[model samples]
Target: MRAIQITEFGGPEVLQVSDVPEPVAGDGQVLIKVDRAGINYADTHQVENSYLSKTELPLIPGGEVVGHTEDGRRVVALVGSGGYAEQAVAHAPYAWDVPEGVTDGQALALVLQGTTAWHLLKTSTHLQPGESVLVHAGAGGVGSLAVQLAKLWGAGRVIATASTEEKRKQVLDLGADAAIDGTPEGLKDRILEANGGKPVDIVLEMVGGRTFDESFAALGRFGRLVTFGAASRQSAAPIDSSRLMKGSKTIAGFWLADCFANPQLLGGPLTELFDLTAGGKLRPIVGGEYALSDVASAHEDLRARRTVGKLLLDPTR
Candidate 1:
């Protein structure tokens, strides 16, 4: 089997393609002939040795995949790592059968972001109907889905932040009530204007550092903010307990990888997301596709923020 491996942590060039032995399915795992893999900022973190969890050397950094079983059943899963290869293994409990109407790319795109967005709204924030939500990186993988799911989950208003105008427009098309420029400067005011001079009820924030500060400041009383990712690779400033107490606001964090420790909470939301896609209520936008050997370029583009929507690796391409 051919796979991309990072013998050492560094940049895109470290992702080298090499021939390796095909992995066999374990007791409760299934060997999947990987067709597509999803690239995420977390993958970059692993490659750079900055992930929250310690990773072993000579690691395969991919986190999600959509592929086929021995009997040719189509499936998608959050296969922790080793997904950027021709074959990988997935725990049977977390692997889902791809339903009628979802493509490999679409299913792969949802493996992490979809499930994260689903839990961010339904579980973390306990989002209420008619509440407002502001999602950062509104055109990226998780942000795109978060914007739509916020609407479907009954948010009265869905506000999104994107880096470019075209990306902002895409977020609007995805059911966001409004889109704002995602610049660190004047971010809170822009969100305030987008919200008709009101703070929001729920915020799905990924960008860390100053962006996290602004997003927290833009919340209304009793507002809940879920910090999921730090794409900027910068640390957010410490929170002041007094500010949170004054507004009765709450701040929470989520990591999909951590949730894997408890497989019990995994399948139900993903099944619901697939059903939404099958019914045309949801769409996981695929912005870029790269060949297995071009994994380096995929990492470059994604790290440089040169793409919108979910990025996929076509192992057979």
Candidate 2:
């Protein structure tokens, strides 16, 4: 089996395609012949050892995979690691059958990114009907899905922030009521303006530092902001408890890993997401597909913000 291996923690440069032994299944796991591997921004942090969890050395950097089991059942799975390979092991409980009408890319999208978006709104924020939502990085994998889900769940308005004009248009096409420049300059004002000169009810914030600060500031009374990632790798100032109390604001943090302990967290929403894709109600945007050997280039593109939507790696290549 060939896999992307990193012996040291650094950047994309550390990733290398190497012929590695096939991973064997454990008691509660199943062996999978990987067809596609999903590339996420978190994978970039994994390679750099900056993720929420620790990264062990000599690692194979992938957690989401779409593949076939030994019994020939096609499934999309969330693996602990080793997904960027010709073969990998998946926990049986974590793998879900791919519905007939869904493509591999769509199934891949539902694994880590889709579930994160689902939980962010349904779990972390407990989004209410007619509530306004602000989705940062609306052109990225999770952001793209978050935008659509928010609309489908009957949000009053969905305001997205993207880095470029083209991406902003894409966000709008995904059903955002408004799309604004993601640059820090005038972000708070732009968000307010897009929301009819009022603060948003909920914000899906990933970019840290000033972006987080501004998003927090733009929240209305009883507003909720869910922070999942710090793509900017910058830290925001500590929140003042007094300010939170004054506005009745809530700041919540979410990580997809936490959902693994409860099967319903990943399985239930994933089934819904798959059904939505199959029924033509939801669309998974695949930004680009790369050969397994080209994994490093994929990381570079994602980190550079040169790609939109979900990215995939064809392990067979």
Candidate 3:
């Protein structure tokens, strides 16, 4: 089997394609014939040795994938690592069968981002119907799914923030009531104006740093802000407890792995998420697809922020 390996932590060029022995299923693990893999900012961060977790040398950096399990069932799961390859293994407990009618690419796109957004909405914030939500990076992988799921959950108003005009349009088309161009200045004002001068109830803060502070200022009384990823590629800002006290607001951190560890708490939302997609309430946006050998280019595109929506790397492409 062939895989994309990062022998050293560095830039995109460090991701080289090479042949490797195939993996076999262990007692409870299932070996998957990988079809599509999702590329996230964390994957690129791992390559640059900037992520929260320690990188294993000669590592395969992909986190989420969709493919066929040993028994020929279509499935998707968070592999922790080793997904950027022709084949990989998934723990049977975490792996779920991809339902009929969902394409391999679409299922792969939704697995990670869909689960993240689902958990963020239902668990971290305990979002209520008819409440307002502000989703950052509204055109990116998780952001796109978050916007759609917010609306599906009966949110009265969904406001999304994008860094570019193109992303703004894309977010709006994905059912966001409003999509604001999140610049250094006037973004909060624009968001408030679009929401009829009302503050938001829940905020999905993916872009930390300066934008994170702006998100803090844009909240309503007793609102909640959940931070999942730092796509800003800069230092995160210090939190002022006093500032949070002013609005009686709350700040929380979220990661799928953390939620997955407590399955009893996550079981409900995970079911709802897959049901929403199966029922046609949510659809994933696939922006680009690359072969496993083009792993370098995939990282380059994600790191440069040139790609929109979910990026999938097909081992068979």
Please name the candidate that would achieve the greatest lDDT relative to the true structure: 2
All candidates: CA RMSD (Å): 1.1, 0.8, 1.7
- Give the candidate number with the greatest TM-score: 2
Clashes found in each candidate (C-alpha, N, C closer than 3 A): 0, 0, 0
Identify the runs in model 3 with alpha carbons over 4 angstroms from their true place: 263-268
Per-residue CA lDDT of candidate 1, range 125-180, in tens?
Answer: 99899999999998999889999988888999999999888888999999999999
> What is the TM-score of candidate 2?
0.99
Identify the runs in model 1 with alpha carbons over 4 angstroms from their true place.
none
RMSD of 1: 1.1
lDDT of candidate 3 at residue 203, scale 0 to 100: 92
Worst window of 10 by summed lDDT in candidate 2: 11-20
How many clashes in candidate 3?
0
lDDT, candidate 3, 1-317, per-residue tens: 88888788899989888888887878888888888888887898889888877887989888878888767888887788999998988777778777776777777776778778888898899989999999988888889999998998899999998878898999989999998887747767887887899888999997788787877788999999999988877655787889889989999999777766754444455566667777887888899999888878988988777788889998875
lDDT (C-alpha, whole model) for all candidates: 0.88, 0.93, 0.83
